[model samples]
Target: MYSRFFSLMGGLAAILSVSGGFGLSDVHAAPRDRDDVFFRSVAGVWKGPGEIVAGKYKGTKFTCDLTGEPLDDKQTGIKLGGTCRVGVFSQPMSAVISQKGNSYEGKFLDGAGGKGLDITSGQVSGDKVVVGINRAKLNGAMVARVSNDNSMNITISVKVADQMIPVIGVTLARDIDQIAVGSIKP
Candidate 1:
C-alpha cells in the first residue's frame, strides 16, 4: 500500500510540475521566476508514462494525461489537472503552484489535510522547477523540467537523512492531435 501511494504521489506530483519534502526547519524559499516566465512555458497538454524506480513497487508503471494552464492577471503560476492510470485503475490528480511573496507555494489535491501533499517550498531554475513536498511524516522533493516546448521530465525523491532517494520518474510530452493530410488522385 505504501508503494502504491508513493507511486501515485510521484505521478500526481509530476502532473503539476510542482510539489514534495525535505525538513520543515530545513525548508528554504525557492527563488522566484523572473517575470514568472516558467509558468508560461509549461502551459499545455502533457501525456506520458511513469515508473516507480525504487522501494517496494520497483518497476511499477503508469500513464498520465495532464493539462497545465498558466494563471491570468498578475498572478504568476500554473494549474494542472489530470488522471493517471495504472492497469485498469484510474486516479484523478491536480496541483496548483503560484508565486507568493519571494517564494512559491502550492498544493496537490486536498493537501495533507485530505490525502495530498503540500508544496512547502519551490524555485524555478532555467527549464526546471523543484519543489519540496510533505505529508504527515513523509518528506521528499520533486523536479519537473520542460525541454523543447513539447517534452518534460519529472522525478520524485524521498529524503533520507542527508540524501534524497529517487522513487519515481516520468517523461511527459505535449499531447498534440495530429491530422493526416491526403490528396485525391488527379
Candidate 2:
C-alpha cells in the first residue's frame, strides 16, 4: 500500500514539472502579500482523515497529521512536515514552499527514500493554493483550499499514461487543543 501510494505521488510530481515548465533556475524571495497571507493562515498543526480516491489504492483510508510553519519573518516561505497513517503503516511527508511575487517554488520530500519532488509552479489565489510537482517518471499536482479559519481540504493527482488520476483527498482541521495550549501558533 505504501509503495503504491508513493509511486503514484512521485509520478504525479514528474508530470507537474513537465507541464509547468520548471527548470533549474535561481529562486528569488519577496515580502508579505496575498501569497504570504495565505501561507500564514495555514500555519499550524492540522489533523484529519482521508482516502485514496482513485487508482490502485482506491478506498484505502488514512489519517494525516501535518504542521505548517513560517520559515521567515515575512511569512513568505513555509516548511510543512507531517505523517499519514493507514492501519499500521505510516509515511512521512514534507515540503518547503517559498513565494516570490504571486508565484511559488519549492521541494516536496515523501520521506520514502530518493530525492525531493520539485514544485515547479504554484500560485495562491484568495484562499486556494495549487502547486505542480515533478520527479523522474512522475508528475502531478496538489490543490489546497482553506474552507475557513479552522478547516482545509487538500487533493493530489498524478498522471498515469494519458489520464490524470486522483491519488489522495484529505480534509484537515486546525488542532484546537494544541492551539489552546499554545503548542502551535494559530
Candidate 3:
C-alpha cells in the first residue's frame, strides 16, 4: 500500500511541478556540484508526471508545468496541467517563499476564473516540504533530495481533505529530471 501511495504522490509532484517555486536554498547561488536551480528565478520551465491517489482516478497520469514572472523577488505564475481523467485545471499559483527562511505562503487558483485556494501554512527544509490551508483542512509534503549530478528524488505525504488523512507515504525517486530556466521564447 505504501509503495502504491508513494508512486501516486510522486506523480502528483510531477503534475504540480511540485519542485517549482521560490525560497530555494542558497544552494542556488552557492558553488554546489549542481549548477542550476529548478524553481527559482524570473522564468523557468519544468515538466514531469504525477499520479492520482484518490477517487476513481487513483494511480492515473497527469502532466504539470510552471510559467511566470518574478514579483517582489517572489515567483508568480500560472501552474496548469492535463489529467488523464479530467481535461484541464489551471491554478494561479504563487510562492513568496524563502528557502533558508523556513516558510512560504501562496494561493492555488481554483480554475481559469474562480477564486483561489489559500495556502496558509507552507514550509520546507533540506529534505522536507509542506503546504496547507490556513484554518481549513488541506496539506501536502514532499521529502526531496538532489544529487550532485542534478538529479532530484522526492517523496510526498499529503493531508487529504477535511479528514487530514495522510494518504501517501514516502515516494521513490521519480525523476523531475530536467529544468529549462528563463523564458520560453516563441
Best-fitting candidate, measured by lDDT?
A: 1
Model 3 worst lDDT window (10 residues)? 33-42
Instruction: Candidate 1: give the clashing pairs.
Output: 20-132, 20-133, 21-133, 21-140
Tell me which of candidates 1 and 2 scores higher on TM-score.
1
Tell me the tens digit of each residue's lDDT in model 3 across 31-112.
2211124333223444344455555446545444443333333332223332212235432233332223334444443411
Candidate 2 per-residue lDDT, tens place, 103-126, comes to: 677676742245567777787555
Please estimate how well model 2 matches the true structure, expressed as its whole-model Cα lDDT.
Answer: 0.62
- What digit string (tens of lDDT, one per residue) describes model 1 on residues 102-180? 6677788777766788878777665566778888877888887665566767888888888999988888766666323
Rate residue 96 of model 2 by lDDT: 73
TM per prediction? 0.80, 0.75, 0.47
What lDDT would each prediction earn against the true structure? Answer: 0.67, 0.62, 0.37
How much is 82 displaced in model 1, in angstroms? 0.9
lDDT of 2 at 53: 92
Runs off by more than 4 Å, candidate 3: 1-24, 27-43, 74-102, 110-116, 134-186
Give the per-residue Cα lDDT of candidate 1 at 166.
Answer: 93
Candidate 1 lDDT for residue 125:
62
